[model samples]
Target: MAGLVDALGPILELMTWVGFVPGVPLLVWGLIIARRRCVWTRTTGEVYSAGGFTGFRWTDQDNVQRQTLVDADVARGLVAGNEVELHYDLCHPARWALGRPKHDNTVLILGWILTSVGILCTVGGFVLLLF
Candidate 1:
């Protein structure tokens, strides 16, 4: 029992780092996505094609007409001439999102939760090791 307990310590210690590994990167990626989508301009776009590569057209703030291609999932169940709500970047009108940006995104939320767990685990592990 004593030997087994000693062996488990190192394994448990290593596990404390698990959250930080994926958590940090995911948090950073989520922040980048949020930053890029910070100033999105919302508008209605008309679907021109609902085939494999969905195509839609919208007019930007400049009043110039523009068309772009997206995945079929973005315009699912929509046919040609159907109007869809979209969000476009202010600086880069060509870049867009299917709808409003979600405030609680999976990556960001998961990353934050995991990072908090990692911090608690690491601190608890150190305290145990020291004692």
Candidate 2:
């Protein structure tokens, strides 16, 4: 019916904008988390499964053994007792280094732009509905 269609128009537009805006921040956050530097030893280690996830465990020169989860890329071609450098976050030791992830500010900027557009669309939708 024409009445139903008219009412749904603004709702659908608002929904589309709302859904699109958060994606920017989500993408940026994912990239930031992925690109953040981590620390690791210069020794290659074997892949071990723990807590339902694959990780690596190695012994440091001090004879201290350390274990951390690595990304799939690092997991491939990895062998036990092989030398590898582990990258880890200085603040968070729990997180292990995989490899250097690319860093770009474009994602962050896109997030901001999407957020602004979403806000504008939402406000406009509300104003239209009120009238």
Candidate 3:
């Protein structure tokens, strides 16, 4: 029992830290912030790297070329020399991610999944308490 609960530690911690009812909304809010705040610019970039770490290069607002390597999570599986859209902050272009966030947005998917599991645990915790 302790092992199982421990495996769910992160989810439990999210609820405990943010409160169960607000946890999912907080996640949703974060997603909304990402979508709204990130500057979506159409440009071509080269995706290179493998075995988990990947990177890409694109020009910023200042026309300064930029590349994200060893730190970009969405850089994998993208082919090289192919034109790709990139999403990044104008003030912080180095932190850019893949464009077309509607497709294969790993961060969003993981966030939703984590939020769901946290909600489930919150409900279970309440039930356990009531019993």
TM-score of each: 0.49, 0.33, 0.38
Q: Can you rank all candidates by lDDT, best first?
A: 1, 3, 2
Write model 2 residue lDDT over 35-114, tens digit each, in one string.
77454435545667666556777665566677876677666776545555665444454555556434455666666667
The candidate that wins on TM-score is: 1
Error of 3 at 38 (Å): 6.9
**Which candidate do you rate higher for lDDT, 2 or 3?**
3
Clashes per model (N, Cα, C within 3 A): 0, 16, 0
lDDT of each: 0.78, 0.62, 0.63
lDDT at residue 122 of model 1 (Cα atoms): 80
Where does model 3 exceed 4 Å of error? 1-39, 50-53, 70-76, 100-131
Compared with the true structure, what per-residue lDDT tens digits does model 3 show for residues 1-131?
76666556556556654553554666676687667664556567776665666677777777898887745445455665556777776756766556453434555566676667666767766655443
Model 2 residue 39 CA deviation (Å) reads 9.3
Candidate 2 least-lDDT 10 residues: 37-46
> lDDT of model 1 at residue 5?
53
Candidate 1: give the clashing pairs.
Answer: none
Ranking by TM-score: 1, 3, 2
